[model samples]
Target: MKVTVIVPARYGSTRFPGKPLANILNKPMIQHVYENVSASTLVDEVIVATDDERIKSVVEGFNGHCFLTSKEHATGTDRIAEVARNLSTDIVVNVQGDEPLISAELIETLIKPFQDDEKLQMATLKSKIKNQEDVTNPNVVKVITNKNNHAVYFSRSTIPYNREKIEVDYFKHIGVYAYRKSFLFDYINLPESILEKAESLEQLRAIENGHSIYVSEVSNELIGVDSPEDIEKVEKFLKAR
Candidate 1:
């Protein structure tokens, strides 16, 4: 299957405005994310799908492929669906623009689920939450999976309510997602379900609609720039390594 990475970058953000344009070292944050995905051998090509012209220009300045999507898109997945509609690739990986430190190996790992199983329509990554603070934090979304490694549910609330034990292994959901090209169109059209609306997670719509999502456990903790302070953390990480 031809795997292409599509990054949905928007200039306007409620928490941190102009998040995509924020400088990390010398380059824009989105550019760093684009370059990281571009370096991956698993991805056939990387495209920046955005509504802003400035974001398009920044991507093009670095000689990267970009597409101007409609501003009406309610979510990142919806924006990615627009780009997927025009592309001929079999698989589209929706890499978040905020995560500049996303590893190429993690992209490769997400792509592997398709090779192993044709039944999986979508796939995402997760890591076991070891910290006690993370377990109770609503900001950190947790996941519970079935025996087959298919996700049963995803939520901000701690899953599996451990009445018996205080420390059962908790898995935090990572935002990176991979979807089959054909499924992308259908996913966007699906109406939001109660669980989805309550959780504010777009992926839950797929689950509620009876689609399967395979989970891959990744070791790396994805560092995403949610606020201006996070830029320094990413810079220090990059410089140290």
Candidate 2:
């Protein structure tokens, strides 16, 4: 399959403005994400989809490809859908701009489901929840999968309740997503479902609409930078490696 990795970046953020331009180890955070995603053998191309010229300029400064998108886009998926609308690739991977520590192998794992099942429309990664705090944290989205490895539901609250068994394994949802080009366009038009609005997760809309989302289990721990405080953690991780 012809796959394109689109990193959605924007200068305006509620917590940290110019987050994509934030420097980590003397290099822009977006550059780190772009480079890591580019390492994937499955990806044919990587591009930054942003509405800000500053982000576009920085991406180009590093000799990376970027496309100027509409500023009115409410979500990163919307921005990616706009870019995917003009692309000719079969699969579009939405690599989150905030995740500077994204793994290429994990991305490759996400795309594997498509090759095996042509009927699969969307897919994402999930890792076992090791941190006790993450289980109850609203910021950390959790997922439950069926026996077939398809996502049954995604929620901020801990799933399965574990009333009978006190120690049940829980899976944390990874934000990275791979979508077929046709599904990408169809997803943007789907009305925001009640479950999605309740949980504040866009992926829930797909599940509510009868679309199957395959969840691939990965061992790597992925950290996404949502605020300025997260940069230090990411930097420490990079320095340790």
Best by lDDT: 2
lDDT of 1 by residue, 184-225 (tens): 888889998999999988889999999989999988887789
| Per-candidate local distance difference test | 0.91, 0.94
Q: Could you tell me which residue pairs clash in candidate 1?
A: none
Give the distance in Å from residue 64's predicted Cα in candidate 2 to where it truly belongs: 0.2
Rate residue 241 of model 2 by lDDT: 94
**Sequence-dependent TM-score of model 1:** 0.97
Worst 10 residues of 1 by lDDT: 159-168
Candidate 2 lDDT over 68-100, as tens digits, reads 999999899999999998889999999989899
RMSD of 2: 0.8
Q: Alpha carbon lDDT of residue 229, candidate 2?
A: 93
Off by over 4 Å in 1: none
Best by TM-score: 2
